[model samples]
Target: MDPVYHIPALLNETIQGLAIKPDGVYVDVTFGGGGHSRAILTQMSAAGRNGSGKLYSFDQDADSLRNKIDDNRWHFVHSNFRYLSQWMDYYGEQQIDGLLADLGVSFHHFDEAERGFSFRFDGPLDMRMNQQAGRTAAEIVNTYDEEALARVLYIYGELKNSRAIARKLISARQQRPIDTTGRLAELLSGQKKELTCVFQALRIEVNDELGALREMLVTARDLLRPGGRIAILTYHSLEDRIVKNFLRAGNIEGTIEKDFYGNILTPFRLIEKGLSAGEEEVNRNPRARSAKLRVAEKIG
Candidate 1:
């Protein structure tokens, strides 16, 4: 694939936020399009004159591996970042010096109509991040109970009209199964404002994205050595909230109660308050508008 797709412009800032050390091992948990991975490699290689540093890249999409560049120092793992810890153990590695994650979906998934990740395309309701994963968007939309569907939209997608949309879907699927992405889109045409939310809910349920992200973060907390930095770029508020809470309180609950001595306890210390793309970057890449970058270093 050509490099026409634009990734987050804060790649260099994210790598530098890691405080990259020569000969240090790094991990790019989401190797989408390899933009961030390529930048990290360039900096790490320049730092280490002998080029002995290593980079471990992980992606659940098998198609991403096809675009892997021929590099001796980098190892690509064809699995979800949720299993970062397992892969680290398999590679006989204890911890990494830095970890970078660009949590946004790759352009390929959205640009490809058949993937059913975009609302612009009329295609099958198939939004599986990993092809091998069970349950497609069609299955959830066609089979889930009205109440469950409403919950999915309300929580994951934060749709205000979730109940109405879920009821409409259930009624529509009763007459005819919601098979294609366009079919569902047509059925919910009355609720056009909630179209993105409905689809986002279906995609989240089909792929269990939130659950996977939580697992990956927990595993990362364990895999990163002390002072090791973890940078996460989240596109949606749901993901950003999780990242923020986790980094600030060392847990997703975001509770920061003080101890008897009035001292707070946290596992991760904030590096920069937040990292965001500049106005110039947003102008060049509109997709960067929704991105929220957060960086933290492992402390406890």
Candidate 2:
């Protein structure tokens, strides 16, 4: 079963992190369902249109673009947020006041069975976030070497039985291609957690999700103005850890380098540590249960 829509997680916290100014520029890198983008727009003043303020949003999925807010103050870019800074540069914009990113798969993907994001429905194993670009999940399941498959499952899905799962997938595909979500799910089916984990591992690899995230965060660091804030909502440990390290130490490794006077050299200061979705929000949107919000502001 899938949620009705991509209810933006930690909506108030995410928007508040932006600290919207009437005459400021902001960006929502994951404009799924336009939930967060619409909220950002609401906070901006009408007089802050072209001259004073503007909102730019980017989403890799073309389906999400249909939900674009039709306001002069809003601009939608159809590209992965990994190129966030590039797009900003293309727009001739130097820097932005804040950036918001709600990471992980959008609810609409899982809701639409044909997208192959969930095991609840049988469909093509096509887990590409940008449906038109990149390899499908089916390709990797059928083509990746046993060890490579195990690595993806272990690292991304955090599956302890990744080797066993990889072996099973390899054996199943030898008879015929494991080409659909139902077939893949059937072969690896055991515990419900394992089912979801395998599917998640496949989706992350099919889209190079982690790679994109790393690039996006690095670019964001370069693009934010001094005092600018970055609010990110992560659904899994892999994402949360990377975001935490980057925010605190200015790198994915989270290594703190000291300057001449032994001052830790980092790009941003933490505004809020990981804040879980309140019980109320989690009750309304089960997906919010795993959400953890982390915010940081640029530091000199």
On lDDT, the leading prediction is 2
Worst ten-residue run, lDDT, model 1? Answer: 1-10
Which digits, one per residue and each the tens of the lDDT, describe model 2 over residues 200-292? 888889989889999999988888899888999998898889999899899877899999999989988888899998889989988899999
| Residue 16, model 1: Cα distance from true site in angstroms | 2.0
Clashes of 2: 0
Q: Lowest lDDT 10-mer window, candidate 2?
A: 44-53
> Cα lDDT of model 2 overall?
0.88
Error of 2 at 184 (Å): 1.0
For candidate 1, lDDT tens digit of each residue in 231-278? Answer: 888888888888898888877677896889998888788986667788
Give lDDT: candidate 1, residue 58. Answer: 92
Candidate 2, 55: how far from true, in Å? 0.9
**What stretches of model 1 exceed 4 Å from their correct place?**
1-6, 47-50, 190-192, 257-259
